[model samples]
Target: MKQHLFHGYMTKNVQKRISEATTAILPSEREMNSGINKARRAMTPTIPTTQLFDIAEPFTKTLHDDDFLIVDKMITRRQRILLFASREQLKMLLGVDTILMDGTFSTCPSVFDQVYTIHAVKYDQSFPCVFGLLPNRLKTTYHFMFQELKSVAMQMQ
Candidate 1:
């Protein structure tokens, strides 16, 4: 398999190839994921808690363009919110008349309580304009998020 598949290929792609080669035996997706995660953890360096607040340069920008960080602010003494959106996304958000917002608590990082997202509808399609990792689901937190976004939008205009 090593001779055929490239090094650093995704676990899922490797699993698929292996399954195709050996039709009778198949590894469960969860097992493959576990193995991959274990390997990754062993290879990656651990970061201190203090350094988590300082986002690295590579992560501070969008993949295809310039900076993506829209806002990084503390709404309260203990709560910090990190908002990300590309300039194009912000422009689309500003041009649209209708926007939708939702918050999910399950998939956010351990330090954040919820992942709040804002979407704008234009030409019958919805585009996610902003993604925010919020500390809590309080009304004040939401208010602050909106205010920060509004302030950025105002500056853009």
Candidate 2:
């Protein structure tokens, strides 16, 4: 058996794999609740020798869930802090009562990595908190993810 390494870039194949994996996990498109483990498929086989901390667009899966939820992406240190900062600001403005807690999480189980820049949000009066960790590595991908998230959050607001 050979273990495939993951890459930072999000390519066409990556999307396909992510969709496949997600569908395999949630075949009925049922509501994904807390403590629900998703899928983990290698998007990139090999990391670039020289690369920036930018992850390709379209992300891996669709983020159509707006219910009380927490999402943790495997990002890096820079991304952790920056993303936290951005979300924190937005939460304050939106009066969402969001918190940037310290913890570790992953989309895939058996991975001991913990995400630092964790965000907790409960939009409606439904769930208590929307909690999740960021990506694992503190590589450039983290920075890029944070920047992109911050940018998007800014534009959305």
Candidate 3:
């Protein structure tokens, strides 16, 4: 198909050589993926870690309402964002004693590390109460998550 696209541009000899080379050694899937990854890495722009907070600041500010709800958020130096629950969600979380925490990597974006979630359980059902994008599964990150939660909970009161 590509050869056809460049049909008139290439000489007959050049076309024959390219065709023979392609047929003689077809690239494996791994080789194709390696080239694709290389191209993507080259094209992808690198954002400074500190600048990440600046980029998200506007979006986080918009999450708030007139009731002062949706105002709780934690952002680390590495740009890990732990978006806490709203006033109503926080109330529900307080009602439950056994909260669950889980990290989902498959849904995580390449920009961050993982999607760490907090769940509140009631009546044998688990409800996701909070969401965070962490740079890694570091102890400090997890500590920040809880510290932010406590700070936010106090604010809700």
Candidate 4:
């Protein structure tokens, strides 16, 4: 019989400890989210900020594109961790059901309509994982992404 590293499901104390650790490691809610209500404050994606605005038409104007799609692996295993942080941050900023449909500005919330859209960066799985408090996936993924990015940089040079 081996001792388990974690429980089958988190206990209340475990959840509390983890939450406190996360708060310390990340930031206080006020510190983590200190810009949403401000006028025209923006975030660089890496830093958590507040700017809950429309999701659809703005994408076209900002990206200068008319067509787009978002796809991803189902939330499970490591994805659960990733989606938790990403979606939590997004919710802190943009609320839960804010992203647009068809990239043409239609509102939908049909379970599959606009749900679980979380990513450390753009929902590019190949872009590298960003699962915090994970099984150290971020470190390895960052290492691989670094190599890939370096290769592209060399090609440009």
lDDT of 1 by residue, 40-129 (tens): 899755652431477767667988858898788877666789999999999999999899999999897777889999999999998999
How do the predictions measure up, each by TM-score? 0.69, 0.28, 0.55, 0.17
Which residue pairs does candidate 4 place in steric collision? Answer: none
Per-residue alpha-carbon lDDT of candidate 2 for residues 8-97, written as tens digits (9 for 90 to 100): 243345557776766566634244422243332244433423222343433322354232222334343332322323334346534555
Model 4, span 1-157: residue lDDT tens = 2334344233445557676657557654466346553434442222223122223434322143422221122233333111112223333323223322111113322222222222323332222122221112344543443354344334434
**Candidate with maximal TM-score:** 1
Give the whole-model CA lDDT for all candidates, comma-separated. 0.83, 0.41, 0.67, 0.31
Ranking of predictions according to TM-score: 1, 3, 2, 4
lDDT of 3 by residue, 15-115 (tens): 56777767558676579779999998887555544425343433443256423224234454545554645566678888998999899898877766788
Top-scoring candidate (lDDT): 1
* TM-score comparison, 2 vs 4, better candidate: 2
Worst 10 residues of 3 by lDDT: 65-74
The deviation in Å at residue 94 for candidate 4 is 31
Q: What is the clash count for each candidate, in the order shown?
A: 0, 12, 0, 0
